[model samples]
Target: MSSIKYLSAILILVGLSTCGAKNLQEQNTLQQTAVQLTDKTTPVVNKNTATPKEEEEEAIALPPKAPLPSKKDSTTAETFNHSRWDRILQKHVSNSGEVNYDALRNDPSELNIYIDALTHNTPTDAWTKEAILAYWINAYNALTIDLILKNYPVKSIKGIKNPWDQKLWQFGDTWQDLNTIEHKILRPMKEPRIHFAIVCASISCPKLQNKAFTASTLEIQLTQATKEFLNDPTKNELTKDAVQLSRIFKWFKKDFEITGSLIQFLNQYTDFEISESAKANYKDYNWNLNN
Candidate 1:
């Protein structure tokens, strides 16, 4: 009976130990559960957080646009009107820069009005230098057109003997021929680009501008004409060792040399390189009518 009492006492001690172990384990489980709950409840923030609309607004900003330049603002000649010349050109010349010679000849009366305007007008201090230049240009072209009409059904301007020498029109107080207008006035002005602006009604000449050149647009017009003339492969052939230039360039080399050498003047307007050694020769000029 004493041995049985000892065994029971031992069993009771083991049960107490088990209960303590269970309690310790439960305390450890509660700590783990608490740590999980704290992690779930805590909030995480993004450093670059923004609303969708705000992000879109920032991405869509537009820069301010610049204003277009006005032609009228550049115009300094106050009272000179080129609307008549403009009208004549619009009626006779095609968009491709071809003259409708047949139509112009059919209605001689229309062209007479243009000549009348040129005759009555004279360059004065009231006009800007730009306007004066434009006036003479228009006068030259108008007189050329009248001369061709007077001798229409002709193959070339050269067909008429001494076309350039013959005094054809009255300019202000004097009778001026093509040679006088070109060599005496335009050449003396010291702008080589005028060679391109003044068309001779020939295939070799720089294409006649379809619109009248005005003082306001003269700067742009001259630039455009020079570029066009240089780029025409038929007129100017640029190569590695040589430049087959138009007869005009050979005739007016002096004018081109005023500012710089002939090659330098050419390189200014040409896209392709004209080497220093490239010698210039006259390309056969096609003097056929440009009608």
Candidate 2:
């Protein structure tokens, strides 16, 4: 009887141990299932992906289609008046190239009139290349100022959404934006000097000239603009053997290089000669508003 009782006790202990092991196995399986379900339901985000704003900017940065002259437009060379733009620039822009947005915003009638005139008077085949270039350059700068006025109190131009991409002006039947004016229209003209003449309302950009660019004065204006920009110590640190240039040179190096090497191009405007093997470094561009 004693032996049977002892055997019964041992079997009971074995049964309890087996039950506990089975429970632990089931618990582990349940935990694994929970983890798998979470993995399937949870969304994963890749940190390297571009945000919506960046994607939009990338799309806008692409070269736009060049505007063609209207078939109905006359071929007779026509000149667009720039006196209105001249007045606006003179009144608002200071000697240092800073703009007085506060004052301009108060009286925008002149700006409105000029923009309207530009909208109606698109360049035609008859327009001289100089006239067209001048028109677009003035149009670009004026429109940029208008954009700033429309969204006044902004710290920087980039703070505004789609500043370059907004189709705020019309040239003939085609709608245009700042990008179209600079990239498709001006850049294809192969006059790299346009880079200096067209200001993006940034600190490092060529100082906004007080006078408007005109067809008759376009050549002088471009030359002067280039020289002034290169000589501006703030924009370019020039030396005989080494030079630190504005970011514009790096961004538009190809534009400047079309006719010759960058060093050669700089020689045309730089006061001192830069060595052919001179080390070149670019200054960080300040995107702050020119105001």
Candidate 3:
């Protein structure tokens, strides 16, 4: 009886050890599974990220170089009244091109009305070259003023984010910003005189005429603008053999050179003659608000 009892006790001890070992293995497996699950569910974060503006710019595809042709019947300068814009300019803009942003902002009814009217009118090929040119010129200036008023009290237009690139308004079916109107449409037209015609709300830019550019007066306006810009001693200091021209000349040198030499283009408008061998240097542009 003593030998049988000893063997039974040993077998019982072995069974308990085996059970404990199995339990330990199961516990380890479950722990490993939990760890895997935690890793799978948790997300790692990155410290460096793009800004909202940067992300938005990245997401936008480039617009077409020029606006698409309008399908509607083309309108003439008479049908499209720019007198409203002319009135606004007369009311608020000074002879020297300083704007009353505070006053305009307070009473924006006229500006809003003009912009609404402008949006309804878009140019087509059926329109005369002069009429189309006048339309775009007025469009650019009016839009620029609208943009400034929308973000008034700012020191300079440059202070506004993406001032030139923001497509805040639509022309025809296409959305247009300042850059598109100036570079894509106006520049491609190969009328270098437009450099002076379109005013950027900056001190160094050509003076904003206090009257609208109409098809009938388009030639006169463009000529007057260019002559006034070049002769304005503040903008351009001219001599027979040397010239300190506005940065406009430097920026759009190619545009001016299309038909002839830079001197030739300047001579057409400059009060004094500019020699072929005249040295050209650009003035430092003032980005201060033309207010």
Candidate 4:
């Protein structure tokens, strides 16, 4: 009986020991798996946190862009106020042949007004067309003169470094050059006398009119300009020795060609008799700084 009892006790002890060993192995396996999962999840969380900082740093390294000037800000706002410009126009109407550029330029406020008007004020209809053209041309010339005066020692218009290029005389708004105001707007509108009407602030350029240009007297003003330029000895002289003339006749030969031969074109506005031989010696243009 004693031996059987002892054998049962030994069996129970061995069984208990085996069960404890199994439980310990299972516990170790579960712990290892948990450690691996924690290791993987920790890196994923760290990686997510790391990426945004790099992206933000890269964004911070870039420079800011410049703001573009609005059309109104660039043109009209820089030229003149509407009411003051009207008053100047009224004054011009009172005397169509005498403009006071000195008075206009002297008043810094009025100069600012002119600049604002030129920078803004786009014409939308025919009624405004003539006025706008004349206004812009006058504005461009005046502004150019102002620029030259401000930077008096500069050699040429090219030295000023403004945005004027040769093709600036196209009619579209995209080609809004100083030359465009002069040739495309002022000239092609069949205001042929505009050649002498808008001054370039140089001896070679047309004389600056003392009066402002108005829509009502635009035609007559243009006619007088054409006639006066052609009649002027410095511009178009018909002589046997040599045909001394303004370079404008040579530079814008194509413009005159539409009317006829240069001499024929001149004759339309003047009483001068230009011979064929005299017309043949058309001189080269001198585009010196027209200050």
Q: How many steric clashes between backbone atoms does each model show?
A: 0, 1, 0, 22
| Local distance difference test scores for all models | 0.83, 0.90, 0.87, 0.59
Candidate 3 lDDT for residue 37:
97
In candidate 1 the C-alpha lDDT for residue 2 amounts to 100
lDDT of 4 by residue, 54-170 (tens): 767766878977997765445333322244545554453223233344444455475566655555555544334556656765666555555554555555555666634433322
What's model 4's overall lDDT? 0.59
In lDDT terms, which candidate is top?
2
The weakest ten consecutive residues by lDDT in model 4 span 92-101
User: lDDT tens string, model 3, 1-291?
Assistant: 999999999999999999999999999999999999998994443436767766566557556477654644435324467998999999999998888888899999998888877787887556777888888898899899889988888899999999999999976688889999998999999999888889999999998999999888888899999989988988999999899989888888999999889999889986677789999898999999898
Tens digit of lDDT per residue, candidate 1, span 91-193? 8887656788899899878678877767777776666667878888877887888888889987888887888888877767888898888899878988888
Instruction: List candidate 2 segments past 4 Å from native.
Output: 1-76
lDDT of 3 at 222: 93
Tell me which of candidates 3 and 4 scores higher on lDDT: 3
Give the per-residue lDDT of model 2 (tens digit) for 1-291.
999999999999999999999999999999999999998894544547968876677779789988976644646456899998998888999987999999999999999999999999888777888988999999999999999988998988999998999997776788899998999999999999999999999998899998999999899999999999998988999898899999999888999999889999999887678899999999988889998
Shift of residue 268 alpha carbon in model 1, Å: 1.3
Rate residue 270 of model 4 by lDDT: 54
Instruction: Rank candidates by lDDT, best first.
Output: 2, 3, 1, 4
Model 2: how far residue 46 lies from native, Å: 99
Model 1 TM-score is 0.71
